[model samples]
Target: MTYDLYIGDRMFSSWSLRGWLMFERFGIPARTQPVGLYSGTMKQDLEPLAPARLVPVMRTPEGTVIGDTLAMAETLAERHPDAGFWPVDPEARALARWLVAEMHSGFTALRGDCPMQLHSGYTDFTPSDAVCADLARIEELWSLARTRHGPEGPWLFGAYSLADVFYAPVAARIAGYGLPVGDRAAAYVARHLADPAFRRWRALGLTKSYDPMPYAMAVTHGPWPGPAPRKARAVDTGPSENTACPFSGKPVADFLELDGRVFGFCNPACRDKTVNDPEAWPAFMALL
Candidate 1:
């Protein structure tokens, strides 16, 4: 059964990222709906899921509405035990839970000072003493998790878990604001930036442009901290490479040009998604 996930703008909604990662990383099927967080339609949009006045609300397949990210995580874990949302080892699992809880309840200073934004990095941004303290606590928890259970893999538990899902936006905050972190912490942030899912999310977010962009700061901006997306342009001709759509194997209906190469999609929707960020799609990238 597919779930209905209500979320806000991907570029600025930190909690939405956590909720999305819980489903996306775990292979859960969810149909996501956008709530206008900035356009002032959030209340009306979320009215159907009454009392859930926040972004990242989840409506289960059975018609149960869940509001909080923690509740959603636990419910999904209970429903899909084999998905490995939590660590397999009992001790590691406990630590992961603690980390997720802390992330949900703490880190107010960092969250307030450095709102998550994926478009570009701020070169001139500076962290306050409170923000620094929050970063230190985060590093301590991350270090403990990685050293104890994630010695092999790049994730906190040696594999993707709820901890990584919860902290994905924190990584974005560190990278976007150019927050000072130790080598180990910096490397962890780099890992998140390099992740395919994370890249795709950021790419999708970049598709929409904001006027007077949310969380706008006077600081100088630089290129995002990861691989840049290929610029896509529309062309009247069909794909120069593949005859079939990369996603559905359907006949090409729309075309996009990237780096002097043309790509065909089954529909305008698919074409538009790729045109905004050609590198986000693994299937399309594999064609190169």
Candidate 2:
């Protein structure tokens, strides 16, 4: 069908992740493109992206471009009904749509406070009451779906469907941050945390630039205590050792922090690990 999908860093691009999962899970043929986010150039960078400050934009051979995660997924599923992107049962499909939509429009408090950061390293930052309330609401929503739809499958409404894709990023955060959740939600997360598509996406997320720093980079890179300063011991090195790759912990210029910028990314996603935990960042420099 000649589909081209644009995405952001796997670490921080939650919306993009959902759309990408749909394409991957269904084995759809598509080309993937990355746009940097923390480079202090989102508006400029996305100028060519056509009408938006977002990622995960999809374009078809017919010259139609679709924005927004759910909108894009729905469009693709419609064209490839045989692909079975949505649920087959009328009742189940309806419920799935409702949940997916709920995710799209609601969760303002959580979205504002937590913000999604796949690579952001966890800091001891405390979430606000509003944010916590949002989390609680989200948990309740997930709990209801599984309870009412558990018989269908292990997924929200049973089986891996669009609803799960819509909530995929949230699910990732719940697992990564170890957020407060109920038993059912926790079980669902355990299974989802192990999903092939999700794993593959996260694995790759650890590989791309998030444009801004991703929380994941914090997982591997840090204010590396560059070797304990030579204690007046015979001067050792002519030149200091090079910094390591933030994402893989490998020494490479490909993952660099310029001038000790806190949020700058070798790849935006890598930076997510740091940005997610602002408290962990010394607030002395700006990556963007």
Candidate 3:
């Protein structure tokens, strides 16, 4: 059940990262092929790989083709419910779907003003009124969602679910661009950064491949605020780690540290499930 995923660099390919991460989380083995966006060769490059002008196009074993972030995530959600891609609660799941949909269809201002990248660093750039409005709304959503779900888990919902996946790019954009999220949203971003999937994503972006989209590549501090560990650099997960996940793309809440270093787990149960199988761990770990 290998899937063919088209993606951009780690620092820049939030779209591709989401799709690939979902693919990995569900255990849908995939052959990853990078397509350089904004490379001028993208159109011609994708003709053979994806045929669409997007990077995160996924071709499934059933020969079905899906593109766009929400669509791809939903498609997987429908087909891989056993993966728990969506939240379990009917209401939570519905709200999750709504948020992902909104992120896909809306936020024109932020998308335009803060393009995705991870190159140098951030500058004090002002968002247009429209982008600011989008940010404000996003922050509000986070605040509300966090307030409601915080008691259960740290993610947008109590546990990590599809909603988090879709909005992850927004967190990255805010981090890379140094946007003012006030308090609640800023805290939300920190939690996201500590998520195993995100930490892996950030670590990879620091050294090797990053999303090359102008905004994504412009990232100077990487996602984490402190300097990346000089010794931590030795873990060569691989050039492709950032593009997907190394463990399950959706690292369970228990497996990750607050800083997302993949240190020891809370107890022995996790060690048996995720640690015993080296091969299993590497799949998701490789992506990190």
Report lDDT per candidate.
0.90, 0.64, 0.63
Q: Compared to the true structure, candidate 2 yields what TM-score?
A: 0.69
lDDT per residue (tens digit) for residues 1-288 in model 2: 588888876767788888798898787888887776665666676677669669878887787888888779889888889887877888768878888998999888766656566543343446678767877888887777776765555888777888888887777666555566778777777777667566556646645543344443233322211111111111212221334433344433222233343222344344443332322222212223
Tell me how many clashing residue pairs each candidate has.
Answer: 0, 33, 28
TM-score versus the correct structure, for each prediction: 0.94, 0.69, 0.71
Shift of residue 32 alpha carbon in model 1, Å: 1.0
Candidate 1: where is the Cα deviation over 4 Å? 236-240, 248-250
> Could you tell me the TM-score of candidate 3?
0.71
The numbered model that scores best in lDDT is 1
Candidate achieving higher lDDT, 2 or 3: 2
TM-score result, candidate 1: 0.94
Encode model 1's per-residue lDDT on 1-288: one tens digit a residue. 789999999899999999988888899999999999999999999999998999899999999999999999999999999999999999999999999999999999999999999989899998999999999999999999999999886999999999999999999999999999999999999999988788777766766789979999999999898766678887888746878999899999889988888888888767776786777788988988
lDDT of 1: 0.90
Candidate 3: 10-residue stretch with minimal lDDT: 232-241
Q: C-alpha displacement of 179 in model 3, angstroms?
A: 1.3
lDDT of 3 by residue, 1-288 (tens): 667887776667778778767765456678877776756777876886455778788887877777787777878778777888877878777777778888888898898778765443375556678888999999877776666654555778887777888787788778767788787677777666555556554444544432433543332453244223222212213222133233333333333322235433333333333332222334434433
